[model samples]
Target: MAKKARVRDYDQFIVRLPPGMRDRIKDKAERAGMSMNEAIVWCLEREFPAPVTLEDRLEELATMVSMLTDSKDTYSGVVHLIAEIEETLDAIGTKGGIPADTKFSDMVRERLDYWREIELDSWRDRNESPFDDANWTSVEEPPEGDPFPNLPDDEMKKD
Candidate 1:
């Protein structure tokens, strides 16, 4: 039986390097336990990574804000934390400089508006709804009638 020929999976490209670069690449490749082509590809991938989008950053910030808001701390503490976060975001915007198409402040204001809407909805749910029973009692003791009358007394006893 004849052996099958190996297929080349990738296209070839001719790259011209400066003097001594080829030897350096060969040495580095050997040290890394990879072929020259693999080393070059790895280097290129490391140097030119995918860029982060503004949407991704906004989502990250939203997640952080949600976490801050959801903390069990006091309202004042939550407000202070949010203020610090806003200041940090402002500093980042100042450092990076605003883009021509979209301002960082505009994005922040949009997010704030969304948060305000959520808070308003929550407040309305708590205060304005007729179905909300603020005086509802906790179930520390069992009801007058046993929910599971058929269950054994031993099973119903608290530890």
Candidate 2:
């Protein structure tokens, strides 16, 4: 067994409360099986776990909104491309799960070629003058303080 450390006395700060609040605190303390001091400490810690600052939260929210907005425009295009690829692959029916023929292989290759051509066209368009300028935004200033809040107890132990 480990030896217990000697208890040290700390300065106590006085606080003012309404007349009946003390009684309520005593009752709550009894209900929670804690002393008034322990209850107060518990309340303070639970309400104010800190690591990330409010500025961080605000910036995080802004970043999320921006990503969500961009994803709205991009997701459908991705889904359509995936569906087209799936349909083309489905058309190339399997012999023991491997594509059976040179003809089917050629068709799949053609579909892939078409997909690559579309991607190249998109890259070219984005790289051109006006679109290229619009593609990136001015960088924002760095946050002043810690941005992430403390993880809840359960999350602290997870992989």
lDDT value, candidate 1, whole model: 0.67
TM-score of each: 0.34, 0.27
TM-score between candidate 2 and the true structure: 0.27
| Top-lDDT candidate index | 1
Across 47-107, the per-residue lDDT of candidate 2 in tens digits comes to 8754543345446545655565667566665655555445445544443332345575577
What residue pairs clash in candidate 2, if any at all? 52-147, 52-148
Whose TM-score is greatest here? 1
- CA lDDT scores, all candidates in order: 0.67, 0.62
Model 1, range 59-135, lDDT digits (tens) per residue? 66577667866777656665665675465455544535322233666676678769878988997887785633454
Alpha-carbon shift of residue 68 in model 1 (angstroms): 7.7
